[model samples]
Target: MAPLVWLITGCSSGFGAQLVHSAVARGDKVIETGRNAATKLKHLEGTGAAIVDLDVSLPEADVKRIVDEAVKIYGKIDVLVNNAGYGINDDYRKLFNVNVFGALSVTRAVLPYMRAQQSGTIAFVGSMYAWWAPALLSVYGAAKGALRAIAESLAAEVAPFNIRAIDFEPGFFKTPLTDMAKIAQYAPTAQPVDAYAGHRAAMGGLAQALIGNERGDVKKGVELMVDVIRGEGSASGRKIPQRLPIGEDAVRVVEGTCKNALKVIDVWRDDVVGTTDRDGFEGEKDYEAIVKGPDAQV
Candidate 1:
């Protein structure tokens, strides 16, 4: 088989950094992008990985330049990983700007090529928080939730073109990106209240609990992603695995939450399926009349 070509954004640190290294280690050609490409991920150049400066939050035209550069150097891209994201503790608008819009911008930029080839894979580094309700991480979860929804819908839309979308839902992985000091601005603030007087306090407590309980290893996390990329594991999809939960904790959360949510869904599953048209009538014309209204003009 020919070596796979990968284009990954947010190569500065965390899973993006590890993924870039892992892909290069496996003899795959990698093109990594960062807002500051020279300083962050420049180390990958020593491993023969191409580094490109790309801001996923930029306009489509700018993103096109990045994609064009990748195609120019690599001939073709086999995988596109949407990984450029940051967490804001308070400035959720900023977080959404990067995590949600930024990711979509990059995804859209590379999609035309992937669609034309009809044989490429797009993986999103979604969070377990997207599936599970982790308190105090609402903004981050919301952004990831958007990505998850997009992946699920895009999976169906792109299947006809033979393009696969996968969501890598990983639990917390140890990385500098997790620094509370750095991401403090993204956290919610306290305000005087009487009704929900302790809400902010409760949120802080939850954050502490997560810090104490969550188990994440950068090496292990990246290895799981590599396995999925190589198709060496049993976690396969019918068309494509729309979502792959990495780490034991991630799998546990998905299974548990889904079990509970499934019960609720099972109860109302029939209600969700539209059985009849809104216009319940004796004839097609009658239905049309009902829809249009009797006294209304066409």
Candidate 2:
């Protein structure tokens, strides 16, 4: 197979950095973008990867420029990794702007090229919190949840074009992104609330402990990702999961959430079914009929 061209966002650190290394090691061409690409990513300059200065939080025009540059350099992008995101404490707007909207913008910019080519893979670096929210991390989790929702819908929409959407749910990885000093700078000052004091303390403790001691290995995770993208190695002959959990903790969280959700649905099955009016009542059934009718818009 010919070497693939990869365009990855947030390449300064964490999964993005590891992914760049892995991709380059496999002889794949990479366009690595980060806010501090000139300095932070300087070490990768002679590694045959093009470095682009890109801040995902920037406007659409900036994102388009980055995409254009990537295409110009690599001819085409075979894969796109949206990996720029940060956790903010209680600041939902800020979190949503960078993690959700920024990623969406980058994906949108890359989609036209991928669609024209009729083949590409877009991987989103999401988190386990997207599935199971932990204390004090609700804002971050909500942003990731939105990203997951976008990836799910996008997979169906672009299937005909052979463009694949994948979401990587990572759990507790030790990286600069999880550094306490950096997190504290990005995180808003915690407000004193009597009722949630204990929960807040517990969350703080978890963050501190996991900062430099996370169990997930970045190198191994990126290796799996590369294999999955190539449709060989460990992922050969297996259906690619739309949501790929990257660690033991992520797997547990996703499975546990699914199990608990199913249990709830089972418990409420009778009541849920009873909501429909059975006796020729115009309800959701009528709506379904209309939706399934010939007049329904595509």
Candidate 3:
């Protein structure tokens, strides 16, 4: 088999850096991109992975340029990982611009090539917080949630083209991205509100406590991703999960949220059902049959 070509963003550190190393170790060609490729990714020299300076938050022309460079190096991209993202303290707009729009822009730029090739995988590195919105990270969670929705919808849209989209939702892990000092530098002060003063202070304390305390192993997570893409290792003999939740905490949060949602839905079933049209017309007596007809395709 021919070696797979991978284009990954945000290779400066965290999951992106780990993925680049893992892919290269497995003998796959990688086009590793970061905002400051020269300094941020200087350690990757002589690793056989091509480094490109790419800030996903940039405009369409910049995104196109990066994609063009990757294709020029490897001929065709077999996989595209939309992993460039960061959290801002109080700037929801800034966070969304980078986390949501940034990823979307990169995906948009690569779709044409993936569609033409008729074989490729796109993975979005979202967060477990997307499903379980924790306090203080509401905007960050929202951005990830949007990415999750995009991946799900894109999966269905591109299935016919033999292109797959996967959303990897990971919990906290040990990485420079979660460093308290680094985070504090970027964290903006909350707007002073007497009612939220205590809550704000508690959130600040929580952020500090979580630094260096994350339990998920970065290496293992990257390995799992590599396996899924190759159809071997942990993902062998199993269908690729549309949304693969990583880490113990991530699994628990996803499962617990699902269970809680089901319970709430059941409790409110009567009220929810009552909202539907109750009028029984003589012409349409078989309402249930009509409603349960053939599934619609988009």
At residue 200, give the lDDT of candidate 3. 77
lDDT of 2 by residue, 1-298 (tens): 7899999888877788899989999889999988878898887787788889988888888888878877899789999999988776566776787798889888998999999999999999998988988777778888889888888778878889989888888887788778878877876676678898898789788777777788888998889988988777888876566778889989999999989999999999998976865787655654685445232111
Ranking by lDDT: 3, 2, 1
Determine which window of 10 residues in candidate 2 has minimal summed lDDT: 289-298
Candidates' TM-scores? 0.82, 0.90, 0.91
For residues 1-298, could you state the per-residue lDDT of candidate 1 as single tens digits? 4789999989888889888888888789999889888887767778788888988878778878878877878888888889888874566887887888887877787888888888788889998989875555678899999999888777767778878788889886776656666556544475535665476579667566766355888877887777776664553442347887888888988999989988998998898746564765445664575455222111
Which scores better on lDDT, 1 or 2? 2
Model 3 per-residue lDDT at 248: 93
Identify the superior model by TM-score, candidate 2 or candidate 3: 3
Query: Which whole-number lDDT from 0 to 100 does residue 135 have in model 3?
Result: 62
Between the candidate structures 1 and 2, which one is better when assessed by TM-score?
2
The global Cα lDDT (0 to 1) of model 2 is: 0.84
Task: Give candidate 2 misplaced runs (Cα > 4 Å).
Answer: 277-298
Judged by whole-model lDDT over C-alpha atoms, candidate 3 comes out at: 0.85
